[model samples]
Target: MKAVVTLIFLGLISIALCAVSIGDYSDKNHPGKCNIDGRILPPGIHQSPTECERISCGDNGFAERASCGKKMIRNCIPGELVDKTKDYPQCCLRYFNCNGEIVKA
Candidate 1:
């Protein structure tokens, strides 16, 4: 009886914790954030030091730029793609090189 009650309480707590949303934010290390639906991995950053930036992600860098909703990608100089599972062939690069810490938008 006691064990059953304890198990139920624990399950409820787990569900509540999982319900919390982390929004969209990711990087080379943290590839994604947990949201209401599920995990959401934001765009990557292709670092560049040259005057003309060359973002090689997909479709003229439009998709990557439009990612993260309102969040803007910056400080991406001489960037390189580290993780290819989530942010490869689609997402941006050098996510850690952003001007500031990664924030969910």
Candidate 2:
């Protein structure tokens, strides 16, 4: 299980780096506020539209991004996904229960 988890995490790194989205604020007219993708964002951290990312806002109106990267095709026989509903890093922590379906781990 440990090895599988490690492999999964390692695989995520390659996928994660490319998909990182830096926040772009179009509200240059108003400093300290951000208008991203037509959404008004105050100063704070926000979840990206994809829900796979964490965006942070500040005085500049731009949101910082926390990317979990992307998933690549794997050779493993993927079964029911071992998933948890949580935030950012936690959300990215996932694996496949190939041997059986894990109702709760």
Candidate 3:
């Protein structure tokens, strides 16, 4: 009985550790993104030289701009899509860059 209890306790600890590790990784990967089961996390917030802004992640995995400066423009694209800098206007267009960093185009 004691051996069984010890085994169960160890198993529980292992599971707990794994859960914590996963949570840490997720938070680190997507700071302001929501946590939805089976959904991919959106890109991180855009950090400009003057200010920072984040994007909103929809349940359908679409991203939208959440904030912008007075003269800055915001744009949204699918997380899986490549950043089409040339296609966007010269105005600030927010999207996830190739390096996964939120950037302004």
Residue pairs in clash, model 3: none
**Model 1 quality (TM-score):** 0.20
TM-scores for all candidates?
0.20, 0.51, 0.20
- In candidate 2, which residue pairs get closer than 3 Å at backbone N, Cα or C atoms, i.e. clash? 15-70, 16-69
Give lDDT per model, in order: 0.34, 0.61, 0.39
**Tens-digit lDDT track for model 2 on 1-105?**
999999999978655553555656748666688786667778888775545566678877656767555443344343332443465655664454544543221
In angstroms, what RMSD does candidate 3 have relative to the true structure?
19.1
| Local error of candidate 3 at residue 47 (angstroms) | 9.4
- Which of candidates 1 and 3 is the stronger one according to lDDT? 3
Number of the candidate with higher TM-score, 1 or 3 = 1
**Model with the higher TM-score, candidate 1 or 2:** 2
Worst 10 residues of 1 by lDDT: 61-70
Candidate 1 segments exceeding 4 Å error: 20-105
What global local distance difference test value does model 1 have? Answer: 0.34
